[model samples]
Target: MTKLKTDRREVPVDEPLDAEVVSFRAAFDQRSPIDQIVREGARRMLQSAIDAEVDDFIARHAHRTDEQGRRLVVRNGHLPEREILTGAGRIPVTQGRVRDNDPDHSRRVTFAPTLRDAGRYRT
Candidate 1:
């Protein structure tokens, strides 16, 4: 029986080693624990910013109410989750949904994240 060095491990000569395993070892970049932490932090920060934007929008429309005093602008729910490719990696985000219940279509207000407003993503 004979042994050969594959990367840093010893493999028996009888067993075949994958060519990809040896070739891609230096090219492939494995995400470290720190990278995972950074990705999670970015995700949380983005989510917080989006939620704050929605809150501010609702506050601004607080004056607009119906005859029964119900607010015209309110949070309906979250939008479909989408993944954004960022420097940190792919981050899944769910933006808040704002529905303007105003009877006049001309005076309707649509809420969108500042990131989208920056022209980074299409609404």
Candidate 2:
């Protein structure tokens, strides 16, 4: 019998490495821990900014009822919900309902999340 030598240059047979590579890339690049934290912070900051702007706008335009049973200047027919910072903390709020035929349109109905329960609500 003659002795034969086998080549050792062939690749090993196993699952393709491409899938593992792809999964690693996705896990590291797409949803990294740092990325998630930064995203959450940015979202909170944006929400705060929006809430402040809405409150300021409402304060500037809103009017109070008068002694003569007439408002000096009605801004909005519908009382808008405002994101308010109270002694307790920031809160998501909805204003009381107003007459349907009221003339003022400045009072906008705003929807904002409270600091305590901000992240729970999603669009």
Best model per TM-score: 1
TM-score for predicted model 1 compared with the true structure? 0.73
> Clash totals for all models, in order?
0, 1
lDDT of 2 at 48: 63
**Cα lDDT over the full model 2:** 0.49
Clashing pairs in 2: 75-106
Sliding window of 10 residues with minimal summed lDDT for model 1:
114-123
lDDT of 1 by residue, 1-123 (tens): 899867877679988768888778855577788898999998898778788988999999999999999999999999888776678877777888999999999999988678654323323
Candidate 2 deviant stretches above 4 angstroms: 1-18, 64-101, 104-123
Residue 21, candidate 1: Cα error in Å is: 4.4
- Backbone clashes in model 1: 0
Q: Write candidate 2's Cα lDDT for 1-123 as tens digits.
A: 999999888666874668878898787566567766665665566556655654554454456444565643333433454444533233444433223223465743434324425333221
TM-score of each: 0.73, 0.38
| Residue 17 lDDT in candidate 1 | 65
